[model samples]
Target: MTKNAIEVNNLTKKFKDFTAVDNLYLTVKEGEIFGFLGPNGAGKSTTIRMLCTLAQPTSGSAKVAGYDLIKDSAKIRQNIGLVAEKMIMYDRLTAAENLRFFGKLYSIPKQRLEERINELFQLVDMQEWKNTQINKFSTGMKQRINVIRALLPEPKILFMDEPTLGLDPQTTFSIRDITRQINQDGVTVILTTHAMTEAEALSDRVAIIDHGKIAALDTPENLKNMISQGDANVFGTKISNLTSELVNKIKSMDVVTAVAQQDDYNLKISAQGENALNEIIDTIRDEGGNIASVTNSNESTLEDVFLAVTGKQMRDQATEKATPVHHRHGPAPKARVR
Candidate 1:
């Protein structure tokens, strides 16, 4: 039988006037990658803080690594390693010096720690850079060192909070591969990330949280299947003569649930009802839209499930820089949100 790595029962955290995590119950299986996903300010950090023994819960109880959250927090801490979103290391220290510092704090023997450090450096293929100062490293290089620093203690469970945030595509893929390798080596991983693609690719089971509660919990494919079995349908299309007036008219349709303009020529639509496609196509035709192509797919993505469950976009679009487009009618129109 598979033993649980972490378990919680009605875990809650509150400020004087606000509740951050509200009566949450959850469990993570041993040696599996569990993805915890939520929007910003959605209690993910608070829950992690509580489990990591950095913050006290307002009520309820949890067992991390088979130790009571309150009664054995030190034991729990000893059995878990945390990789925070922000890299934690001294910029002035060389990679070897930083690892030695952290290993000493964990009370590892000098000879064993040195051997382990060398082994890890080789594992990440960074042995040649071990003597280099962190200040001289690029963001990706620094992140790699940060990850190895957390592993020095050889904890049973690893809590990775946005380990690949702000990384280039190549670095992100490298980090993800590293995560899989770690899990294969018998470490249970709990990953929190905003990237739905990352979550789907890495997680064996995913839990979507919103407003301090679990909105849905299952394997990524199962969650996507929930969307596929529903009445909602997603469509992608390109229009040769797309305009703001046509876009607005489609948005006003009773069948349309959400509309996003991908580029000057392309649009992604989500709608329900039996005649959703007909209604949408008729609207486009009425508005003098020349349809270049249309694709209706029953296959649902993690992003699609996220929207259906949370009723909001997965990431904050306001922070992303929109590409400038040349529209036939006037200035480029901003993409509409549900």
Candidate 2:
């Protein structure tokens, strides 16, 4: 049997009376990117803190890169690298200075560490800015350097807590590409993110975490197929000049099982059958509904799976957050309690 890079069994964490991570069980194979997905304060960061040994679990047992989580936390730290939700590099420090400081903590040989840092900087094509102070760098540049700092120790498993969080689309894609490149070089990575699209695109397998539990764990395709397993599913279409009358007419069609108005001019219609979309479109036009744009979606997405299992939109939890990103913890009960 192939040895898992990390194995978590019934792991749980509590801050005061609130349970942050609740009886979580998971296994991560070596050299594959595993995504831990959930809305903000869904225990994603707390779980990562436990796995990284930054915070100890209230109850549970596990091995990270073959060492015990509690008994050999130092050993685990030695074998694992962490890219925290908060940027790791010091703002006042130059990029090269920051790398050197982190490298020294791992006791990496100065000669070899220099080579590694240089290579990492070059990998992201930011070699020219090595001597520049981190504070002067753009958000994307700071995040990239933060990521490379985690790799300074040359660890076997890397835990990235939203490495691309707060980054623009271009920088987000850069982080994703670099993550894949790191996995290809034989480093197992565990990434935590709220973006379903990011998880679906990057993870080999995803664990949908919510309310301190695993809602679903499967390959992206299979997780999506869980909802798409039925013969027919939801297909969304946008209509111009949408009215209650037009919506009711679409809902009354034989092809449609359910219809919901997404916005003033958008409808999310559910149906079964290969011709479901076509039939709905024709019916709308027949009823004097103006067509603006029709997006005929047949495939189930990660968001669909999340909603089906949790009965809550991921964005619902996200939008409820009034605190800033860095201050936010797993859940409201966990983060703030008297």
Candidate 3:
């Protein structure tokens, strides 16, 4: 039987009058790359902070790495690694120096630490640059180091926050390959990202959070199917002489749920009810739109699912309240595992 790496139940966080993570319940199975996606200010960061033991929750409970969230925080810290959005390393230190500094804090034995450092450097293909100063490295190089820094402690679970936020295409691909390799080595990963393609390609299961709550949770394919196979109808059309007026008219249609301009001549639309596509075509003809082509594909992207489920809801207004929680077990060691 597969074990669970993380379990959360009604985990809530509030700051004064505002709630950040509102009654969230979730479970991440061992050895799976779980995706945690949400729009801005949707409490993604706040929830991660609480699970990482960087912040405390207001109510409810959780178990991370089989340790109670509140009582066994120190144990939890020892068993997990964090790769935050920002790189955590010293600019002046060389790659090897930085890794050594962090490894020492974890109190790894001298010989074991040296072997682990070499193994990690080879895993990320950074052996040649081990002695090079971090200040001279490019963004991608720095990020690669950041990833391995989090692994020095040999954690069971890894929390990666926007692991590929601002990298070139090649670098992003390399990082993603590394992520898969790490997962294959039996490290459970909880990934929080805004990139739909990344989440769809990497996650075994995904949870979409909106307005401080889970709006949809399922496999990427299942979530997309909810938009394509359910009541919603997705249409892709191109007009040679597309105009803003025509786009506005389509948006005004009672049946149209979303009208996005792919370009000056192409539009992706979602609608509902019977005869909706025929009505859309008729309206385009009446409005002098020069039809180029149309396609009704059964396939849907994760982005489409995200927009369909959370687009119509009012935009999130609550700011993540960063309240520091005093841990009886003491704060996690700085840069020890992140």
Candidate 4:
């Protein structure tokens, strides 16, 4: 059996009689890109905070990089780095200044730290912007520097909480590429994201959490296969001259379980089993419907598995209290984890 990079047993977090993470258990292998995916306020960030030792857990136990979550928190912090949902850099600082400041926090040698910082900036193609203050940079440029700052410690593990959240497509892909390169260099990565597309693209394995519980945990392919092995199918279809007659024809098909009109020219069809697509198109044509597009992709998708497990509820049951807990604050005088 492969040794685990991180291990959790019955981990739980409660805030004022409300459980944020309830009896959660997970084991992430070393050098694997592990994804934690869920909707907003699904305890993804809360879990990371606990593991990173930013927030103390209410109960249960975990080991990050062989250090105890509770007892060896300082050691764990020493071996790990974080790219939080919110940027960690001070906007008034230059890119190089921000990185040097964080690098010094880890007590790295001044000479070696400077070399590492330059290498990281070069790796992200941001060497030119190193002297510029963060407030002067675009969102993408700021995010790039923020990512490299996390790398200053040369940590064995990296926890990225929505690293590409709200980023443009180009910036998102750039971050994704950098994440892949980090994993290739033997760093284990734990990523949390709401975007299934990003999760599917980067994760070696994923755990989908809802209501502060593990709904499903497996490789993306396996999760998708779970949906494919089930009875229903999901397909995207487009038709020219779409009419009530054509829509009704598709709904009437024995193979089609249901049909929802996405637009005047498009329909989303849910059906069952092997030959549903062929039969759907056949019925559409028989009804004199002009076909513009018919996609019969049998490959399973991550969103399908998420829907099957989580349904449509995005609300968190445990932390639904006085104020919406988009974030959970730690004990007073919370120091920045550099």
Among the numbered candidates, top TM-score falls to 3
lDDT score of residue 31 within candidate 3: 98
| Native-referenced Cα lDDT, model 4 | 0.83
Kindly list the per-residue Cα lDDT of model 1 for residues 1-338, writing each as its tens digit.
99999999999887766777899999999999999998776788888888888787889999999998987777887899999989999999899999998888888888999999998898788999999999999999999998888899999999999999999999999999999999999999999998889999999999998878888999999998987777989899899999988888887888877676778999878789999999999889988999999999877788777766776333442222222322233432342221
lDDT of 4 by residue, 1-338 (tens): 77899999999987786677899999999999999987666777788888888787778999999988877777787899899878989999899998888877777888998899989998899988889899999898888888888888899999998899899999999999999999999999999987888899999999998878998999999988876756677888888899987787777777765465668998767678678778887888888888998776556577667755775333643443332322232333333435
Per-residue lDDT, model 3, residue 164, is: 97
Identify the runs in model 1 with alpha carbons over 4 angstroms from their true place. Answer: 239-254, 257-267, 282-291, 313-338
Which pairs of residues collide in model 4?
Answer: none
On residues 39-121, what C-alpha lDDT tens digit does candidate 3 reach at each position? 78888899999999989999999999999999999899899999999999999999999999999888888899999999999
- RMSD in Å for all candidates: 12.4, 7.4, 3.0, 5.4
Q: How big is the positional error of residue 337 in model 3, measured in Å on the Cα after superposition?
A: 15
Worst 10 residues of 2 by lDDT: 319-328
**Candidate 2 lDDT score at position 241:** 80
Q: TM-score of predicted model 1?
A: 0.86
Candidate 1 weakest lDDT stretch, 10 residues: 317-326
* lDDT of residue 165 for candidate 1: 94
Model 3: weakest 10-residue lDDT segment is 312-321
As for model 1, its CA RMSD to the true structure in angstroms is 12.4
Error of 4 at 50 (Å): 0.6
Q: Quote the lDDT for 193 in model 3.
A: 92
lDDT of each: 0.86, 0.81, 0.90, 0.83
